[model samples]
Target: MFGSLPLGILQLWHRKFRLLTATLGIAFAVILVFMQMELKEALYASAVRYHEALGYDLIMLSPKTPHIVAARGFPRNRLYQAQGIKGVSSVSPIYLGQAIWRHPSEPLNRRSIFVLGFDPDDRGFEKLLSPTVLQRLRLPYQVSYDRLARPEFGPIGQMIDEGMTVRNQVNDSEFTVAGLHAIGSGFAIEGSIFTSDLNFQRMFPERSASVIEFGLIHLDPGAAVEGVRREILDALPKDIRVLTRKEFAQLEIDHWSKATPTGVVFGFGVVMGLFVGAIIVYQILYSDVQDHLQEYATLLAMGYPHRYLKVIVLQEALVLAILGFLPGLVLSVELFRLTAESAHLPLEMSLNNALTVFALTLGMCVFSGLLTLRRLRSVDPAEVF
Candidate 1:
């Protein structure tokens, strides 16, 4: 193995251009795979963030909903079932839906916005806000919105102050912006205006309050979540599914991974990376074995075992893998960062992900080395000369 490392390095140096090309191929594949992983995280994070921003530990939705990340919606009526579970503390049934907010008073500024209906006086409501929010809480009907999405909405705390009731001109009802809250919005929905359940349902009366969507449940301190989860699941009717925080999160993530085009596209990239790596590594190693057939034959003629040649090839392949994967990984980190910043999406490069890449790269090298076994066994000094 030791001897083979120098031999592999020397050969790679001799075929610098080919090595460069193969390395570039590997890098491109790694970068794409990394991007997909990041997007998956973002998709999951965005959904969790929406709920988590409310400072809840467990989220219970209508039984039929697979996960929040997928196409998720409920009648806003099922929020009642989760409100009575044991070990449960504060519970707020929320009505989440969308409607156009025509700032009748502002004219030209009418825009569609998200509607979150929660009790401002609910016991757990204070846990859900930032200091900025607590300060704005005194303002009637105030809500949070992200600055990045609504640059025109003025600064946080700035009153878009002068607006008439939120007319779901389509539904023909009205609500007013208490103010906006900043839980954030990106890719999922635009952030502009927000209002409390009292105001929200009034404007969108065509919507329901008791027909609340999902409920955010807070577990009593030191409680057993698994036991509590099973009890909750067993208690709920089949029409609704119950998931613990982690299980619910995973389900949502898997649903998005399987159902979305972005998921499919990224999956293909990972497969292609493995395929390209195998092809390039196999062709190069096989060609090198054939080129050096004479030298291998001479060694065999001098009583070297055929297995020695195989060992040398395997070692060389491994060394090449380490050589290539190290640089590819380092470069991938930087490339992923640049892609993330420009794309404005989270592209996480987790340790597990990197290790998976490294393992795949090494597997490709081993596979490529094995392709030379038959040729190595048949080498003859006469044939080479």
Candidate 2:
């Protein structure tokens, strides 16, 4: 068995040019799969950053709300009703909207950024922010900027860190950049601003305190989340929908993965990569089988079984998968880093993703070998002679 393994390897190495071409083809396929998965992950992760950063036990949304990016909110009066629930210990509101932000240096330049407004005094709100930064938010007209946001938001974050007084306009209303946060960006909204409810109201006078996009309900210690969810559902109006934190996060993920065109494109890219890989591998294995037809026929004439020939081709497949996957993996990591830095997306290469790609590569090569075996079975010793 061990002796036959080297025979497969020798057969592949016999034609150096063909082997090189095959390896490159396989590597390209692996890279395609990696990028597709990476983009898919980034899309989901970026879209759900707000959901993940917040530490809420239950979330309240309007029946009209479609997603976090462009959601129409429920009435703020619902928070008062939610506080009456048995397990509900606290209720807070978050106002979400978009505004054109003027560049700090380039005053004439502007771009739209997602706006998040929450009550600074509301201890029930969960966020990935420093307490000190939250304290600074108590100051009127001051907001925290996402440091990792795209450059189109201008240099407000950088300027603040440099001890410069940086202020930008949100729909012509001015706000100070008091601190920087790192919640990152999403596909729908590339830049985000965090501010207190008071400052938020000041910037958007059209948005009344009566209407809010999100209501966060915090349960008492050891309180049953499902019980609280049920209690809230029974108490809240039918116009409002209640969801657990996990369910809320999934809502955003589903929005991007199924409801958006970007997700479909990435999914299609992965399938095309697999198809291309299969074809390239099939061609390589077919050519190798053709080159060794005489040898395989001699083995058949000597009473060697068809299964042994199949095993040889499979061994070659295994070799190709391993050799191609390593270089592909190395290149993919570098690409992920470059993308994360340049695009400022939360792109990462996790261990599970690596293993998944490896399994796919093996499967692709092995399946290609199976297709080439039909040619192997047709070889006859007399015909070869």
Candidate 3:
């Protein structure tokens, strides 16, 4: 075992450039896998959890159909009904819509935005924010714009900060930006305005059929959410969907995780990257094994156990894993930053995610080398001669 150390080192030193290329190829694949998975996770999280940052304990939405609040919506009366449920502390009715904004004075470019309708005094409206934000958000005729919408508004924070009004070309006459919000880092409900539920209806005259887009629920202290959820679901009309806040979040999680094209495409990228990395590592090590067969045969002829040669192969795998993992980890971090900045998605790379990728990379190398050991089993001393 010890004798093979110098031999392995010498072989690596002599063939450093070729070996480096293969190692980098595997590392690059590892980086791609990390980027794909983390981007997918970031997109889903940004889509679903942006509101969770508001810190609401329960969320209610239209039961007949499902949609990400940021993407699609439905009209409903359940917003008020949720307020009336037992063990319910309060409720806030939200009207969601889309519109365009431009600086009252600018290049005069019309920009599109997402619009949220809410109440200033509702108790549930305050659950997701501090009194400071609530006060800021309640400024009369004001709407709060998210990060993504800031540009269309003309300048990110200040444009919305100074205040601007939005016209419901379709519904209400005119509305304004109440304030700007930072619900979570990276990406938000951008290019949008907030308005009173009344004003929302004014703009959406056709909305007599749907009172509020959704309702936010706050339970009385110590209330059982699951029991209340069941009670609400059973009591409500079939068209209304009722779920605990946790259930609602989980439902969104499951929906995007399993149903979206983005998730599946990224998942395929991860699997393919892993397979590609494994192949690269296997082929590189296979080449190295072929070159060293004579040395290995000499050792076997000298009474060295076959198991000892196996240890050398395992050593090479471990060396590659360590060398590759360090750079792969760095690559993953850089990728996360670039994606967050460029994609405008919240791609947070936790230590666990990097660690998981590192572990997987190590496993792939070891398994690849181990399986390719079949080459050693067939090497004959006579062939080497």
Candidate 4:
């Protein structure tokens, strides 16, 4: 076994140029797979940014609402009704809408932004917005801009940080940037604005306070979330849907992963990367095997078993897998960082993703090695003589 392993290493080392080419090919595949998986994970993670930010035990929304960004208003009375439920501490109504954000410096350039409206005193936003910012949002026509918003939204966050009074048109109404928050942007939402419900209505006069987009329910201490969720669902009408905070977040994730084509596209990219890697490795392994058929035949003629020869090819694959995965991992981490900084996305290298790509690289190389075994098996010692 040891002898065959050395032979396999020697075979690859003998052709340093080919070995380098094969390692680079595998590295390219690793990078492709890692980038696609990271983006897919970021897509799901970013989709639930709002849900994760909200401090709530239970959430209520209209059943007609497909996702938080596309929320349909439910009667505000539902919040009052949920407040009367046992084990309920409080309920806060929130409003969501899309408005054209006129660039502060470029008036002609506009982009759609998500707007979230809630009461200033609502405890549900305590985790997301500081009390001071919430207080500032209480004033009409004042809104907090998301600091992680895409750069296309302009330098509103920078101006706010410099203590400048930044004002811009959100729809037909001009709103002042009172503060900045850190809820990042996603595929569907380029930027976000937070304002009090009063200001939200001011920006969209057609919407009524009686109709709100979401009802955040905070359960009393020691209240079971699942039990409270069940109670809320039973108490609410068919038009309303009740979910735990985790379930609410999952709902948004599902909408993006299942309801849209983005997830499918990313998944397809991963498959294509694997396919490309396998093909490249196969070509390299096949060529290496063909080049050394005479040496392999000599070994076979010496009574060496086919299994020993197989080990040599597999050993080369293992070496290639290791060499390729290291650089790919390093490059992927840097790319993830650059993407997170530029796009304001939640892209990062996780332990699971790293392990997954490594496994795929190993499997891809090993499979290629197995394919080359056919060529080795057909080599005739007699024909060589």
Best-performing candidate as measured by lDDT: 4
Give the lDDT of residue 332 in candidate 2.
93
Which of the predicted structures, 2 or 3, would earn the higher TM-score when compared with the native? Answer: 2
lDDT of model 1 at residue 25?
65
Clashing pairs in 2: none
Could you arrange the candidates by TM-score from highest to lowest? 4, 2, 3, 1
TM-score of each prediction = 0.77, 0.96, 0.85, 0.98
Comparison by TM-score, 1 against 4, better one: 4
| Candidate 2 root-mean-square deviation in Å | 1.6
RMSD of 4: 1.1
lDDT per residue as tens, model 2, 114-225: 9899987786433566788889899989988989889977876778778998877888678888788888776788888989999889889888888999998889999999
- Mark the regions of model 4 whose C-alpha exceeds 4 Å error after superposition: none
Question: How do the residues 232-272 of candidate 3 rate in per-residue lDDT, one tens digit apiece?
Answer: 77777766666665676677676666766667888899888
Query: At residue 158, what lDDT does model 2 achieve?
Result: 70
Q: Model 1: per-residue lDDT, tens digit, 118-161?
A: 66655445644555554554454455554334433333334444
lDDT of each: 0.63, 0.87, 0.67, 0.90
The segments of candidate 3 whose C-alpha lies over 4 angstroms from its true place after superposition are 1-6, 70-77, 102-111, 127-141, 148-153, 160-175, 184-191, 202-205
Badly placed stretches (over 4 Å) of model 2 are: 124-127
Candidate 1: list runs displaced more than 4 Å: 69-88, 100-114, 123-128, 131-141, 148-194, 219-242, 258-265
